[model samples]
Target: MGLWDKIKDGLTTDKGEVAEDAQSQADNAAAKAKEAQDKADAAKKDAGQPDAPAAPAPPAPEAPEAPQARPADEHKPKRKPHREYTVVSGDTLSEIGARFGVDWHDIARINDIPNPDLIYPGQVFKIPNK
Candidate 1:
């Protein structure tokens, strides 16, 4: 009976050791699988080919454009003569127009006045070139 009990105790101890060894092996396998996945990711990055395409390089800066030459006539417009007149006391549209050698109707039209007889003292009027 003593030998039988010793044999049963040895068998129980061996079973426990076997379970521990199996658990250790499983942990090592999991660690190795993680290391392999990390190495594969690093290799993909080093190859410069990711899951998505790389962004395109920005376009090269454009060169400044040269100034264009224009014709001489483009700088000159048709010239018109302008005259300045100052209003005096008791001045009317007829008197101002006669003094400037222009018709009262022409004066009123050029100055954009609603009433030809509404000229007042101290107002300046522009007489247009005929």
Candidate 2:
């Protein structure tokens, strides 16, 4: 038999093995994507909390309520710092740094990107200092 025919025959026999491997890889990728999507959905839900409402408009001056004092050293939960920015058109490392009042080197280090020039539009970058 010719080389082409022999190769085709081998491939035909191995097709199942190749298909199984491809399917396994696809399943793994799909699972990972689902996990990432779930995390994103959870974050969105957490960010949309309605428990905290904006402060009411300043009321006219009135008699203050009796102060209910607490311990001077009482510990309260620290608020998580916000640190994310999306890349937009006409955006550069220097420009973003200037806008956020941070150094370009710090931004690059926080993102772990070797090349700042490689960032593209729609890519979200972490604005560190958390």
Candidate 3:
């Protein structure tokens, strides 16, 4: 069985093991983020030293852009909103998409899945709006 299959098994057979795995992942992610932040802060601080030329202040976060104009369809009904799905044993993107009448690629794009082969059980992915 593959790593995904092992993860699926972990979800049902060993909840504590799955929780530990999740905690490890979360810790790794947090460490990476902190390291990146430290590097950025160091670079910024070094730039403003008396010997170096003054660095420009970082730009503020941009506000969300206004939605582009679309042709109004007052008569047509809106499609159903998207939903979230937790992956389970024997689940695949194609299978889930087929269940929801959505394309597997679309589901991957919605969840930003770089490698479709790497989905783990218990991972909650947001389905796109139809």
Candidate 4:
């Protein structure tokens, strides 16, 4: 039976019967949809086209290895001191300061810049340590 006709008939039945009927119809609809999808997949295979994309393959297992011991005296290399930065085209004091992890005002003060907004290309500015 058609969906609307089934629903109309359900409205005239007992509430419990109506709910059961609706559940049955929904289950049938789901079954039909799954069947249609299976047929489509088969048709695509017959036509030499790829089926719907599949779930990704699981990642490969990792190899278990013993951790290597390090010498106690070994330490991370120290960061080199930042001294100067030559301004390039489109280089701003704020951007240069950000690259060196310092404030633009500090860079301008250290470089004795007269106008903070008047920096030009090839002008070198001193970068202060953070």
For each candidate, what is the lDDT? 0.81, 0.80, 0.85, 0.85
Query: Under the 3 Å rule for N, CA and C atoms, how many clashes does model 3 have?
Result: 0
Cα deviation of 39 in candidate 2 (Å)?
66
All-Cα superposition RMSD per candidate: 22.7, 27.8, 26.5, 13.0
Q: Write the per-residue lDDT of candidate 3 for residues 7-117, one digit (tens) a residue.
A: 887777567877999999999999997787677777877888333333557899999999988778955887756789999988989999999889999999978999998
Model 3 residue 110 CA deviation in Å = 1.2
Please tell me which model should have the higher lDDT, number 2 or number 3.
Answer: 3
lDDT of 4 by residue, 22-54 (tens): 999999999998898889889999999999754
Model 3 regions lying over 4 Å from their true place:
1-81
- As a whole number from 0 to 100, the lDDT of residue 116 in candidate 3 is 90
Model 1 misplacement above 4 A: 1-80
| Per-residue lDDT over 1-130 for candidate 2, one digit per residue giving the tens place of the 0 to 100 score | 9999988887785678889999999999999977876776677679994432224478799988999899775677665464789999889988888888888788898789799887888988887653
Consecutive 10-residue window with the lowest summed lDDT within model 3:
48-57
Off by over 4 Å in 4: 1-82
TM-score of each: 0.37, 0.39, 0.38, 0.37
lDDT (Cα) of model 2: 0.80
Shift of residue 81 alpha carbon in model 2, Å: 4.8
The TM-score between candidate 3 and the true structure equals 0.38
